[model samples]
Target: MSVVDVSGATTSRVAPFLQGLAREPIVWLIVLIFAVGALTSEYYLTALNLENLMRNVAVIGLLSLGMTVVLLTGRIDLSVAALMIFAVVVGVIVMTEIGPMLGGRWLVRGNTYAGPIIPVILVALATGTMVGAVNGIGIAYFKVPSFIMTLVSLTALRGFNYVLTNGHPYYLKAPLYGWIGDSKVAGIPVSFLIFLLVLLGLIAFVNGTVRGGRFYAIGGNEKAALYAGIKAQRYVVLAYVISGFCAAVAGIVFTARLKSVDAPLAAGYELTAIAIAVIGGTALAGGVGSPWRTLLGSVAFAAGLNLLAIWGIGNWYQNLAIGIVLIASVGLSRTSRKKTHS
Candidate 1:
């Protein structure tokens, strides 16, 4: 009787844990990939490589967080990469113009500003927010499909970025501007730390708040959410605004890290963001995902790319691998949804 009781207690505790793990197999997949990498490469498990990998994925990870939210709402934003480029370009230009008026030197061989960091950051974030508002308005008020609306924004914004810079890259001369990307806090990159904070905040918002639950409700069943008296359009618009703000933040960090911004910077990143979110186990049909899983997906993506680089794979093959992974993820999501419904 004692043995049976002990066995029953163990089963009761472990069954739910196993079921949770089964529900998110991607987590296990990530673990497996890391194990393989550690075993295969002498440098893969080193602290330096790990840090570099985190830094490399931080921007995409930020974008993925926003993408996850949008996906949760049964929508998508294809203009995030272009918005990032536009924000960086506009921010840098505004800072350059303001720095001279503020009595700062024209540093870096006459092409960069030495001050106005705060104002520039604000301008960039505001620009992204405004663009997001437009996207939201068009979709919510005008009843436009999110895919088409953002697709048009993507094209127009990319063109605007090119027109603003005339196809040339803008370099920031201020060390302070680059510090966010270059500096470390307690042996961790500042950019990664920022990413970590954003991730945590978003997790709190989505999992711990009623407002976040509404987003899921809307995505899961729009008619039901509307019947429940939730303002579906407002929440959808808010999601886009959040996505735009995130893209702007990513742009600033990316520019600081690279010390330069180009009109074409982060091209194709929207697709990559979507891929990361979907691969993280977010349902493409919407209403099922977590930011924590998206973070793991981003890390897995960065790791795969790093491994490819180490093995001397070309960019084309990298893209191919990403496509395959995306297809598989979407298929799995669809299957899971069907099973749940059945």
Candidate 2:
């Protein structure tokens, strides 16, 4: 073959591959993170370290998954992290105070308070859902901007968190908490398993349900969705509700892992969740992402942080890196979107 023909054939073959990678940067980002992590430290490649990494990122994973759903519906929830902390705090209080009335006894061992685990779990879920419902109602019914509404919630909840505990940490003791946070089945961390299960169910829900489609439609263009007879307001509310519920679940996992809850326990986690969703290829403008993508983003993000820690990078630098990555990802997404439209 002529030299030109050879070049043409190679270009044709490689073009599609490049396009595929562009369409799914999270995949390559994850590969890159793992590669960097393996090179940065001898311990990074160890089985135990990787397992710990997965377990630790489970909370962020859940939060990011929830953020992705909210982003899909063209909304945002800045209060999720605060809600997580607040919900867990409420749950623990319910277990410690309300449990006694319900015949649940507490045995203090050192600084940890032991009580019935059921009340904590139930109250946390309820607290999260209630907060989420309020957020939804304000945004959907009152037509409040999502950012403003959630920001207010974030502030209020954060203050309430401190009020509930008087700026101190509350340590709790429970077998189920330990199991959910630390135990493993067949060598897999239970926290990671829970994250995986939620990921799967969310995938089914967002991709398989009619309401899920409505979320996408509203996100893509609310006016058109409304014209099509889709209830945009209801779906938007549902999205925030889901976000709140996910935050609550994450709070449970986080409190379990630490065996404690504090005002600052999950401070700034909402930003991490947004970073995860955006890095996972979810468009901030909405209607262009999935749970599977968020999973890859979460893994990549966790791996990157692990690598940074192994390299002894400081928290300030890590935050800088997150900001850089978030901006770059959004830029790339917007560029790709423009190109597609053009």
Candidate 3:
């Protein structure tokens, strides 16, 4: 009886409970929202709506992929949406002028702006890569805070988008473009198929590839990584570039499917992507997450938002809900980390 301490008993009892709670907050949130969604709307669980929900999210979902890689290194890219608009506009212009020369014509839904599938894709991906290079150079070599650097680009890129569009939407009249967005493979949107392919590829890159593991190391401690002979700067730049390429890929799919290109196609999308990255358990401080969690996180986020839309929640209220969820998730993540540390 001389040294029996109540603290030891408390620690033993609380640790397991806290550990389980910490392990999967996003899963809990997803379950809770999904159940609520099912109860509120009769159409929530329908087959057609399910397809639409997944297809609609594919764009923002794509952005989340890039954001996942960037956040791992404790950086952010605010210009992603702008870059998307730029890519869409550029691709559409190239397609309309050159498509006829290469046996392309607007056929789907009475639109015809996409050129040859292969060339359109190459141009879009290249544009995205270039944008990422600019962003990376600003952050890595210039020693600029990612926030400031990306914001400047966002502002400037929006202007570029406006310059290209002249405030008008460009429609693609090609059957190919329409098919990319609306056609199905084994009964799934081809765009959705593209998303799955890209997501899976990225999952492998972030989880299995050597460069992926090194990204985490760069995020965790640049100095230590440098000491370990890791080319931290080069990899970091590559991350931004990859992120850009992802945005471009998504852009090509979106423009092709919609048969339309506009300056505002992806407005406010970066916020959604950033939110998904955080909710998926990626530490804002960097070095604590991956693509698997991000993939689920994107689904959870898009599903929840769609639930609100289906339930007839007002747009303003939807934004409020998003804000609330984001704040609460971050708070919960912080608490979980503290408990784990203690």
Candidate 4:
């Protein structure tokens, strides 16, 4: 081949490949992080640690799934962690109150009720949905900025959680709840499996459903979506509802795993979830990103934490490491967007 022909062909093949890498830089970042972990620690690549990592990331991963959808619509849900806590609190309270009515006794073994698990799960989900609906209505119809709306909800819901629990944690002795939170299937944790199922469901909804695209449209340009006959408000509201539902599910799973529910159960998890979503290449500006990316982000975050622990890092340094990761992820996201647009 002529020199010019060879050069042109190489450019043609390599340019698209480079572009693809730029579009999803987090994938490379995750690979790099994993490589570093594997090189630095003998235990990092062990199956037990990997399983523990998956179990650890499950709640945050589930929260990030909902947050990704909300961010896709150019909104935020600061109340998600609080909502999760509140949902679990409500579920525990209901179980405590209703166990006797259902001819079930409070199990002294774990200081938990031996009540029907279904009712507790339903109530937790419903609580999250209702709270989410209120957040949606305020932001979508009332024209409240999502940041402020969800901030208000964060405070209110957290207060409610405290009030509901009387500043104490409730132990759940229900075997079924424990199973949902702690059990394993085919060598995988149930919580992780639930997170994976939610991740898949979200991926399908966002990529395959009309309503899912509507969220992107609304985030991409609300005024334009509205002009195009899309009920932008409703979809925005739906996004919050989804977030709330995810929070509720996370709450239940977390409670089951810990075998207890506390007022501050998931405090500050909202920030971690947001960081995961943003790190996963989900655009903070909206109209871009996917569940798959968020999943990668969640895994990366978990891996980083595991590495820190293995290195004998203290909790203080661990948090600092997360902050650094968050900043780096945001910088990478901005750089990628610039490259794509330019």
Show where candidate 2 strays beyond 4 Å.
1-23, 103-111
Q: On residues 1-342, what C-alpha lDDT tens digit does candidate 2 reach at each position?
A: 635688889999999987976777567777888887777678998988988898867989999998999999888999999999999888876667765677766736533568878778889999998899899999999999999999999999999999988888888777999899889999889989998989999999999988787878988888999999998888888888889989999999888899888898878889999999988888888888898889988988898888888899999999999889888888987887788679
Span of 10 residues, lowest total lDDT, candidate 4: 106-115
Prediction 2 global C-alpha lDDT? 0.87
Worst 10 residues of 3 by lDDT: 106-115
List, residue by residue over 226-309, the lDDT tens digit for candidate 4: 999999888988999999999999988888888888887777789899899998888888888888889988988888888889
Output the worst ten-in-a-row residue range by lDDT, candidate 1.
Answer: 105-114
Badly placed stretches (over 4 Å) of model 1 are 1-23, 103-110
TM-score of each: 0.91, 0.91, 0.86, 0.89
Query: Model 3, 264-285: lDDT tens per residue?
Result: 7777788878888888888777
Model 2 scores a TM of 0.91
Question: What lDDT score is found at residue 86 in candidate 3?
Answer: 86
Q: Which candidate has the highest lDDT of all?
A: 2
Deviation from native of the Cα of residue 308 in model 4, angstroms: 0.7
Off by over 4 Å in 3: 1-23, 95-117
Segments in model 4 whose C-alpha atoms lie over 4 Å from true places: 1-23, 102-111
Pairing residues by index, what is the TM-score of model 1? 0.91
